[model samples]
Target: FQISYAGATDSSVQFIFYQPIIHGWRETDFFPCSASCGGGYQLTSAECFDLRSNQVVADQYCQYYPENIKPKPKLQECNLDPCPASDGYKHIMPYDLYHPLPRWESTPWTACSSSCGGGIQSRSISCVEEDIQGHISPVEEWKCMYIPKMPVFQPCNIFDCPKWLAQEWSPCTMTCGQGFTYRVVLCIDHRGMHTGGCSPKIKPHIKEECIVSTPCYKTKEKLPKEAKLPWYKQAQEPEEGTAVSEEPSFILEGWSTCSVTCGVGRQVRLVKCQVVLSFSQSVADLPIDECEGPKPVSQRVCYSGPCSGEATEYTPEKAELLYGSLQEFDEQYDWEYEDFTECSESCGGG
Candidate 1:
């Protein structure tokens, strides 16, 4: 004899033990029927069954599930803020999962400007909603509190000395060369007078004197005075036996004939004279007007020996003859002549 279980049959029991069921068992007892059971289940057998049993049970159940769990409703006794709904209303709960939460009293509530450190308290429901919705409110636009940077001072070394003196309580000295001048203001001293006599004053120092001088005259020599003489001295008397003579005369000795060529080619005849002259005074004492006189009249001659050709004067009346002679002479030979003397008589002597 046999006994039957509630969901078991002999064939079903054999089928459950032998077949590999991958899915599609919604009516089976091990199928997930509630959220606590997770999503799905496997099958196993533990108690009595007949030979026709088609049902099995899994006492040690295994479940496949997602990580995020849905929030549950808060309990009534513990005070807490209720989860917000889509209708824009905030509700408070008596108790959260294990402890009391802050009560939500208003909408559009603001969270802390800073972070919520820990634990829950009365907070803005809208801010909580926004936070839960993964949104952050922007910071307010306000002027930044300014903090000025401090001035930095650097240390000085011997090789990199400061241009000006650092201490006001010390006196400094500068060395100068000869023939040099300098002006300095001394403001500090080592005698601990840093405030009372801190005025600037001009100080000049000349290392050496610049002296220039001229030479002095000697005082040892003495001399006698001499008589003064006139600037222009008198002329000395003539030498002994150099007596003066009476005025001498000049006489014409002989008249010689010469031929002078005039104009281009024609010749003229003229007479020249030889004379002997003497003077009573030295040549330098003679009157300057003696050489100024009218010239003597003369006739031109053409030949040196006895004149055989007709002599012509160089006058305008013989111009035609002169021109014809020049033409004929120039065709035969080339000749040139010049006058040695010219005079204009203004005095009576010629």
Candidate 2:
């Protein structure tokens, strides 16, 4: 019996083929551990590969065929070893990885901020920590546990200030005419040190006019009434005089004019002796006598006005003459100054 197989193909027939199929996934080698030690992780990636070309390509190129499939994660844990101990780390519990403790530090102080008046200066304060290699690193302020921070602010250039200084008033420039005097004003401190910080508005006045305007003269009330009368004319009573005898007395002349116009000067008066005999004889030709009385003063201090300027002073020449008496004449003498000229300046202060 001849039996035939259903749906059979001839041995000599050929088939057409396109791209190769993506059968399975391949993973890259695990990269270096993310950290040296103390519980870090390592990573590896999964990708699709072409079977014929055997080269890495884009996922879409491999997905041209329906057999291509997307890859999944291929990561695993690494660096499970414990960390070494160091002084830079702080102790928390018994067994655990060490971490650095934070501390505070400061930089050098800065220069003074102001030039003359009060000023302030500052510096930077930073929180830092030491690493395992003994290198300093910056950290947050909150991490610096119990360290006390340094003050960033300070004072500089604290001293006294300079002020305006005025010299004493100077002498007037002229003796009898309008004139002015001047003094020096400077900027200095109380210690006589100068720094030139004085204010211009508050400086003292440096120049002023002479203030005196008139001469000084004696008042009427100051003179004695008896001093105006001649010594021989003065009233005197003898003890019941048995005989009337003429007694000699002194005669004083009026004072001369002052030698200066507006400053201290000198004046003098001449004295002469006269015989008293009822005022009937001429007294001008009377003889000198050794009278029993005090001698008169001829030289005296005189002030014309406030002392100022320069003037030539003259010395009075004295001469003596012999008269009718054998001994010496007793004469009363006094001196005074004449009125002074007007002061130099009319206004402004002196």
Q: Name the 10 consecutive residues with the lowest summed lDDT in model 1.
A: 140-149
Candidate maximizing TM-score:
2
Q: TM-score for each prediction?
A: 0.11, 0.31
- Estimate the Cα RMSD of every predicted model relative to the unseen true structure: 49.7, 30.8
lDDT of 2 by residue, 230-317 (tens): 2133233111222322333455666688777765555565554443323233232233332224434343435566655555442122
Model 1 regions lying over 4 Å from their true place: 1-253, 258-289, 297-316, 319-350
Count of clashes, each model: 21, 0
lDDT of each candidate versus the true structure: 0.26, 0.50
Q: What digit string (tens of lDDT, one per residue) describes model 1 on residues 121-165?
A: 233222111222235442211101011222222222213211212
Regions of candidate 2 where Cα sits further than 4 Å from its true position: 1-102, 132-134, 189-191, 199-202, 214-350
Q: What lDDT does candidate 1 reach at residue 122?
A: 33
Worst 10 residues of 2 by lDDT: 318-327
Give candidate 2's whole-model lDDT: 0.50
